[model samples]
Target: MKEVLVGSACAIALALLAGCSAEQPAGPAPATRPLDPTAADLVARAGSYYADEQVLQDAEATLVHRCMTTRGFRRPPPAPAAPVSHDEEWRPDPAHRRTDGYGLARAGRGEPPDPYFVALAPAHQERYQRELVGDMARRATLDLPSGPQLSYPTTGCLAESRAQLYGDVMEATRVTSVTQDLHNTVYLAAQADPEYRRTLARWADCMKRRGHPYGSPQQARNALAAERRSAAPTAAQRHEVAVAVADAECAAEVALPGTFESLLRRHAELLPEAQRAELNRLATSRAAALRHARQVAQR
Candidate 1:
């Protein structure tokens, strides 16, 4: 009896050890952080953009569809219509005098608004009155400095608040492009002449006078260089030419599009193996040099 009882006790002990061997140690859980909308808003604000939720959310679906379908991804459904503020400065010269006012004071000066801006008669106008004023408030919150300078979010006129939760900074982001940025800026400046001439003509027709005004800055720079010598530019002027040329090259490259893979496949196959990138690099440099030379010649 005692031997049988001892054997049974040993069997139970072995079963207990087997169970222990099969057990595993528990690991620590992952750390989590809470959402901070204010901090997020501040970060979004730092991007130097401002717009109502209307604008960003308005483009959500269309943008997603275009972006994704082209890349072969599942696209989301479209968003609702954009929330429009009362003000629209892109309305042209008749309504708001002095175009975007360079974020200047709100005096409603020299303004003859479009005849079409009617808001369902009287009562709605008072409600939407805040709409335009609200836009002003949002822009004021942005604290834009007054000067004959570029507007905030430089590309478009502000339609609403300046802060975007998810802003479109293609213009801002393009500044970082490796081979494209510098050349593009120069390209824009180079082509700015006709614009300058046109603006000058318009301002002149308005009985205003400012040489090299209302057009491309090169008009101004060229005018400045005219004082020294038209044939030979100074070293400083040569440097300006270099910058303008580089910027122009970047712009031309930008206007010419197609992904590197697709574009290269079409043309690169025609080139010798060793000449692909080297050819590009040399051409880019030569173009920049020629622009600098032209500026010097103009000087």
Candidate 2:
């Protein structure tokens, strides 16, 4: 079966693990804590902007489908809708937090193949793929401030749609890239903090008492992945649900999520001056993009 374990949240969890170690350090400084209201508001606004961007992307996809139809190619209808909150990265729903342990198992469930595309001739299928994403070799790379390069198609309906929506694809990519990097830095710092490690230990013990002996939520998720490797989709999902519930219960019992959120806030405050400046820029750019997305939606 295809690996479905590792959605956006799981990806973040994996990134966090990079900073974790066997030895715990001193507790976080009281003065450097993450419970600031202003910072929370900023993060909330940033998250809202990301949601707006998704709306714009969905609009662009629709435009691409229309363009493809105009070009005499058969376009499939959009895939069935799933729960939107399920895909959101950072925001954890308290009521459902324990249901998808880090969202890894949930991420692993592959989207069903589109029947329309499947019925198409192989040549048509190839054309559709090419037209949708374009040739990688022909794409342009945008160097991000976060020390990463993003490769995007310079030509194709997808590219055209993006250009129309954002006016400048590179600028859009730069803002989003920097924002992501800033967010990642916080996660890394949180994982490294001694307080976070202590909370994680408590969560681990809670999981252990529940018959899930895992070092961390990420570790538990990995075990689930290996365990479900040969299971049918339904069976795998059942297992994931059970594990996620337990994970959530453990997290709540230990107040890990609240502690983690506070740690992230504290770490975010400790970012280098240059990164903080970039985050401000991202906020400004995102605000502008939100306006543009609204305009696009209206049209």
Model 2: residues with Cα > 4 Å off, grouped in runs: 1-54, 74-81, 86-109, 135-137, 229-240
Give the lowest summed-lDDT range of ten residues in model 2: 81-90
**lDDT of all predictions, in order shown?**
0.32, 0.65
Score candidate 1 by TM-score against the native.
0.19
Query: When superposed on Cα atoms, how far off is each prediction in RMSD?
Result: 23.2, 17.6
lDDT of 2 at 28: 69
TM-scores, in order shown?
0.19, 0.69
lDDT per residue for candidate 2 within 62-136, as digits (tens), equals 667777787667667444234346222223354564455455555657887878789889998898878777776
Residue pairs whose backbone atoms clash in candidate 2: 4-108, 5-104, 5-108, 6-104, 98-244, 98-248
- Tens-digit per-residue lDDT, 122-168, candidate 1: 76555344443334333311211121223233222222211121233
